[model samples]
Target: MYKILKKQKWSDTIYSNWIEAPFVAKAAQPGQFIILITNQKGERIPLTIADSNAKEGWVQIVYQVVGASTLELSLMNEGDSLYAFVGPLGIPSEVENFGGKVLIIGGGIGIAPIHPIAKKLKELGNYVVSIIGARTKDLIIMEDKMREASNELHIATDDGTYGQKGFVTNIMDDILKKESEAIKDIWAIGPPIMMKMCTRVANEHNKQIWVSLNSIMVDGTGMCGACRVSVGGKTKFACVDGPEFRGNLVNFDEMMLRQKQYCDQEREALMLLEEKIRRQASNG
Candidate 1:
């Protein structure tokens, strides 16, 4: 059993948990992920390694309650334990200093996964510039953490409730132009659509870009074939080959379509879970 050492509620739908998994923590890197099961009958839940402490034997995972499985996991507290937590899966992002300057972009919960990457890049003596976005001010998270990790940090919001009042791409475009000569690599993590747009921006600037595909991963292994994505017109499994890949080569349209394959079922499961919870509350 992997015990939850700490729990934090970022928002109504988002959460952060620190789990005691010594082996996984020791092997964790900036871009790997873990698959957790709430119980014997629970579905596998794949989440990126947001942060880790090797000495403490704890891995921090940030997740959003999107369906029944996640909602069930969120109900767990600091003292709770997960039935199974298997990880540091997938390839770690290339950590070498590329010249000197690199750009990091994060959208919503994607910010969590990018935090460690930004910190690591900074430690390697690279100038890290990070752009983080959410729908509004209330939705923004980990501002202090990202700022500490980055040499410079920019924020964007869809509703103008904080930072720039536009899509992150707007800021990305301007920054890429400003840093064109110095910036050589970029890392973006978020929704498929967001990453697609970021990739487009990076390509226009002629910079190498990597994006995370953990959202499409299922079963946390190549056996499921569910994380298959087209990269450079070839199939690659996100879990085994990478949860991170060259954004310029990924077929974002197909990946986004695959992400919705089980939406209806996910919605139904959430609805049923809500009904059950309401009944339990009423009975209690």
Candidate 2:
């Protein structure tokens, strides 16, 4: 059993946890993920590695209480033990200089995964510029952390609640226009729609972005066909091949459809869990 060393509730739905998984923490890189099982009855779920400390024997994971398994996980507290924690899986992000500066684009929870990437890139002698966004200011996350990781940090919100009133892409365009010569690599991780849009913008400027497909993963292994994605007209599994890929070569339209394939089933599972919790509370 993997022990939960610490847990912090970021909001009503989002939580950050540090689990005692020394091996996984030692092997984890910027873009790799972990598969977590809440209990024997719980389904497997993939979560990005938000942070890690190999020497300290801990790996951090930031997750939102989005579905049934996550709701179940949220009920647990610090010092609780997890049924299973398998990882430092998937390909790590390329953390080279890229001959110049690089751009890091993270949206909502995407910022969690991007935080380590930003820190790594900066450590590797690359000037890191990051832009993070959410629907509104209250939804913005990791502002202080990203700021520390990046040489320059920018924020955007759909509403004018925080940094910029427009989307992150707006600032992306402005930066690329001004420093197209210095910026050679881009990493964008977020909701599918946001990634698709960022990819489109990058392509227009004759550039490509690396995007993480963590949202589509199920088994966190090639055995599950659920995470199949088309990249450069070839079949690829997001788990074994990558949770990160060249955004320009990916077929986001098909990916978007595949993401919704199990919505009804997932909704049903969540409802059942909620009802069960209610019954337990009433019984108590």
What TM-score against the true fold does each predicted structure earn?
Answer: 0.98, 0.97
Residue-wise lDDT of candidate 1 within 1-284, one digit each (tens)? 59999999989899999999999999999999999999888988889899999999999999998899999999988888999999999899899877678899999999999999999999999999999999988778889999999999999999999999988889999998887888878899988889999999988988778999865666777888888999999999999988999999999999988889999999999999999999999999
Candidate lDDT values, in order: 0.91, 0.90
Query: Model 2 Cα displacement at 267 (Å)?
Result: 0.7
Clash list (residue pairs), candidate 2: none
lDDT of 2 by residue, 95-193 (tens): 887767999999988889999999999999889999999888877888899999999999999998999998989999999888877898999989899
Clashes of 2: 0
Best by lDDT: 1
